[model samples]
Target: MPAGPVRTRDEVVTALRDSAGVGMGYVPLGAAFGILLVTSGLEWWWAPIFSVVIYAGSMEFLAISLVTGGVGLAQVAATTFFVNFRHVFYGLSFPLLKVRSPIGRLYGVHALTDEAYALLATRPHAQLTGPQVLATQILCHLYWLTGSTLGALLGAGVGLDVEGLGFALTALFVVLTIDAYRSAPDVGTLVLALGCAALALAFVPGGMLVAALTAFLFVLLGRYTLRRRRVA
Candidate 1:
């Protein structure tokens, strides 16, 4: 297949501008997370550290409570796995194969946020290159880091009551879900997700989110297998 377009100066500038817009949404959310961390009894510095190291978006927000509550390492590990397991499907279709360099591919995997994935999923795969992908991810990461650090500083210097800040993450996810559905409207996928969620809520009340996602993955794989067999 032909590489759709050469990376031109204009293309790079456009990509940067596009990514900057997406990154803007992260600023307030990241700041909220930072403020929440400090308010939750963690040192303000932990905000940036978690943003840079954990980089798990909503999970990082949950981590503040987890760490402060003295959650066990085993439980934390299990939660992280379940929360991030969807990335396995993301990797199957993401343009990581276009990333030629080993280091670039490694960073691409590490930097794969919901925002980044949503942005890429909307684009034609042939049009994307490693540099463009990396540029977008890096910009988003910088926005998160800067916003979190600034919020931490503000929290440390002059504390503010940031009630309901956690809702921002939920709002972001809702927006991303809408965008993804609009990009690729698949009724089967939607049905599978809803069914799994319902079943999980009915049966595995404690682990609803993880159980739903796991069941959805299995159903999705089964569907893919049937489709492939039909094609063959």
Candidate 2:
């Protein structure tokens, strides 16, 4: 793929400005996570620690329960691996090459959340630069950090009733699913997903998500095999 022209700091600034609208959404969601963390019986400071360290949006929410429940590290590690396994595929085509320096590319990989990846994917590769990509990712991270910090403070100070905040992650996923379906508009994929979900629910209710994803992987593999055979 062709690289965009080398951009100056001003271009990076413009990219940040363009992303500002979408980045704003992160703040409230991050704040919700913060509230949940505090209410889950953790210190307010844990909000920033999770935001900066774990940085896994929905998984961080799950982490609250995991920590509270005293789940073992092995389970947490395995769960995290399965939950975030999709990122392996994201890196395959992500514009990591556009990042000029090694350090920038490292950060780019670390910051490649669903939002950043979706925003970057929308732009033409030829129009994107290292700095612009980095700027968008950094801006999104900052938004989350700021929101979570504020939420933690609010929770600690006022003790707001935030029991409903847990639904925020579910709502976010539903929105993402709708956007994905609209973008692809594939009935076969939808059918396969539904089938997987049903099977997982029936056989592995406790690990439905992992089970469904595993089944989907098999379906995809079979499809790929048939395609390759036909091509040959």
lDDT of each: 0.81, 0.80
Stretches of candidate 2 off by over 4 Å are 1-24, 65-72, 89-100, 117-129
How would you encode candidate 2's per-residue C-alpha lDDT over 1-232 as one tens digit per residue?
2344444666678877866754566777888888878888999999999998888787888899999999999999998988787677567657778889999988888888877776676466787877888888888889888988888889888876666665655565566566656765879878998999999999999887778877887897898899999999
Error of 2 at 69 (Å): 5.4
Clashing pairs in 2: none
lDDT of 1 by residue, 83-102 (tens): 88878777767888877889
TM-score of each: 0.85, 0.75
lDDT score for candidate 1 against the true structure? 0.81
Clashes of each: 0, 0
Q: For candidate 1, what is the TM-score?
A: 0.85
